[model samples]
Target: MDPTAVGRSGAVILRPMRVDDVAEAERLSALAFAVLEGNSDLTRPPERAAAWQVRTAHLVSRDGAGCWVADADGTMVGFATSLRREGLWILATYAVHPSWQARGIGRALLDAAAHHGRGALRRMVGATTDPKALRRYRSAGLDLHPTMVLEGTVGATAMELPLHVRDGRPSDHEWMDSLDRGLRGAGRGEDHTLLSALHPLRVIDRPHRRGYAYLAPDSTVELLAASDRRTATDLLTDALSGAVGADVRQAHVTAANQWAIDVGMAAGLSLRAQGYLCLAGMKPPSPYLHHRALL
Candidate 1:
């Protein structure tokens, strides 16, 4: 059992996470990820922490019961946050303080959080390449679909970006949700609100093809979903073209989205296999790039 888990063993107690725990949990998550993802090119810790704080607060507000924290005395040592949108349940983030690893705390935290997905029609998460994490998700019965990432300084491209996309507003919610359902099997619901808080929304709404993408401050494609590959490809072109000369990246892109690969290559971004989007009861969605935490 996790000490401080179940409210038990050692000096730690496990309990449902609250909004107040966001700050400390954010610190622990950053520490854990720094060790897990040693990528020298990752966003600076301060920027990453700020983003983590926003997303963590959003998850806690939307799904308090799905979030759990392991308290070692009064300090948060391990935690997990999750979200459910209808039949889709996803692990938002999970972490244990570096000093506290290998003590079964991570497993306990995960088991407590995974309970939130018990009745979902499908479960998925965009996971890092950590082998232990990989094994854990595999043990939970999700098939692993390795994902690729496009990252580097924005370079010149001859790719024709013939399609155009416009900024999206609240009025487009219904249309976006409907497209999400058709492609991803479930509507994004409140996740859009969270994304809106951190980035700008651009949508392609044509009769033959349609799609939406959230452009991050760093020029990364935060999340994108489209009715077809061409529309998605077009959206990427427009998004990247608009961000030339800035560093950019896109992650959680599976082989199903070859258009993304082709576009990234054409834009002069280097591609590499990075992580896995673990899934159960669904195939990889094409022409879509999942949110880092909200897949």
Candidate 2:
């Protein structure tokens, strides 16, 4: 099924996905991800497509799992995926086939995602640094919230640190809680999604646990090193180590604290990309979560 052919008027249809759509979805995914200019920077497009297809297939396979697809003549043109959490839904991905562009297909996908969160007062979305998507998100009633972001292929040291330690377990909620507090002190709001707190459960390296510096379930990588001079490097090592089993062509870091920048530098993670924090509603409070973990 083509992700671009979704949402035709009378003959076309947009509805939840089904089991049979996996192969076409994977195909569309490969075609889509293949457009990246830096496909070889880290992970390749096929790997990401496979992983996304697995996740989407899982969503379509489960009961109460919500995934909306725009189908035209039995072809999947566009699709949106979400996960329900604490009675609210978090959008995972919303995409329309490249061939189906400028036809409101993306909007249809977003609307479907919003529809999945019915009765919930608020919804959260995370967008990457893709400028085109950023514009579309803003037009879709998403507000660009400021955040502490660090990205660049350009290499530079933000700060230096001098502490090293092994990764902490996900079950170590106490330490995580403390780290959260420290992060909050550095100016982060209370937008804690599972992705933000993705730590502990993630295993590092297929052969052993030493492959990743920080391992967590969702996305957060608690620092393994902290110092005035080399904190950024330690954090980068932790993040790269933690990114196993996932396709990451590049790394984007967002942090409000000195430690975040410092560790990023030490790890040699570049400051290559930039983006705005997208908020769903009017301004709320100070110290909002950084952009990288907004979801």
List the candidate 2 regions with Cα displacement exceeding 4 Å. Answer: 1-11, 36-46, 61-65, 129-132, 145-252, 255-258, 275-277, 281-294
Tens digit of per-residue lDDT, candidate 2, span 158-178: 323324434445344334333
lDDT of 1 by residue, 204-258 (tens): 8888788999987776688899988888887888788877877887777898999
Best by TM-score: 1
Count of residue pairs whose backbone atoms collide, per candidate:
6, 38
TM-score of each: 0.93, 0.60
Lowest lDDT 10-mer window, candidate 2? 203-212
lDDT of each: 0.82, 0.47
Off by over 4 Å in 1: 1-9, 39-47
Best by lDDT: 1
Model 2 scores a TM of: 0.60
State how far residue 208 of model 2 sits from its true place (Å): 29
Model 2 alpha-carbon miss at residue 222, Å: 11
